[model samples]
Target: DAGVTQSPTHLIKTRGQQVTLRCSPKSGHDTVSWYQQALGQGPQFIFQYYEEEERQRGNFPDRFSGHQFPNYSSELNVNALLLGDSALYLCASSPQRGWDNEQFFGPGTRLTVL
Candidate 1:
């Protein structure tokens, strides 16, 4: 089965522009979560989507939003980006109906804002 995949492997943007990153979840999974990892920092949960609806959100700002499709794939959008937004944007997937499932992470789409 195909594992999680992310696009553009790397990205560079200005401080005020917007960027959209994509993710395809592993086969048979229904939950998608987005995380942000700054340089030398652990991944920080951004939000999670299940049943095509956002179920939980972390301590990120409104600029960070996401969407999940019926097929379980997902996209994360960051608007009005900042230099601080430069980090590895990781997408994780889990089977929603299962117990405290561990998330499988993508290699991540690194974003650098100048």
Candidate 2:
């Protein structure tokens, strides 16, 4: 069973640009969630997708959007990025229909905006 994987372990971008980060969920999982973790802060949930539909979402701007594919993988898209967007983007996976399920995180994709 493979664990979650994220692309471009690290990324650098300038303010006002757009970025897309990809994630592949763990085997046998159908739920994918995205989180943003600033330095010294706990992960903040962005949104969660199950069965290819968003089931839950957190308080984030419209700039933060995501998509889950049939393969159970997901992609997080951020538009008109700001310097504040610079943080660790984490992808978490859990079994479907289990809110109490423990989420497994990926190594994360570090984004640096200048």
Candidate 3:
């Protein structure tokens, strides 16, 4: 069975630009989480979407936003991008939102901002 998948494996943007990254959840999954991983750093949780609503978020600024579609796919939108935004954006999907639920992650979308 196909697992979570992301698009635009690589991307480049300039400061103050906006970018949107896509994610398709694994079959039978209904929750999606977004994370940003800087070089040599662990993935930092951005936010999570469930039932098409923003369920939880981390310390990320308001520039980071996301949406969950009826099909369980998602899109992460970053506005007014900064050089610090350069990182690998990861998407993870799980059957449900809970600490016990196992999440499957996509390879990731690398975003570089100049």
User: Per-residue alpha-carbon lDDT of model 2 for 1-114, expressed as tens digits?
Assistant: 889999979999999999999999999888999999998899999999998888889999999999999999999999999999999999999888676989999999999999
lDDT of 3 by residue, 1-114 (tens): 999999989999999999999999999899999999999999999999999999999999999999999999999999999999999999999988475877899999999999
lDDT of 3: 0.96
What's the TM-score of every candidate structure? 0.97, 0.96, 0.97
Could you tell me which 10 consecutive residues in candidate 3 have the lowest summed lDDT?
A: 94-103
Per-residue CA lDDT of candidate 1, range 1-108, in tens? Answer: 789999989999999999999999988888899999999999999999998899999999999988988788898999999999999999999997764878898899
By lDDT: ranked, best first: 3, 2, 1
Model 2 stretches with alpha carbons more than 4 Å out? none
**Superposed Cα deviation of residue 29, candidate 1 (Å):** 0.4
Find the candidate with the highest lDDT and give its number.
3
Assess each prediction's global lDDT (C-alpha) against the native: 0.92, 0.94, 0.96
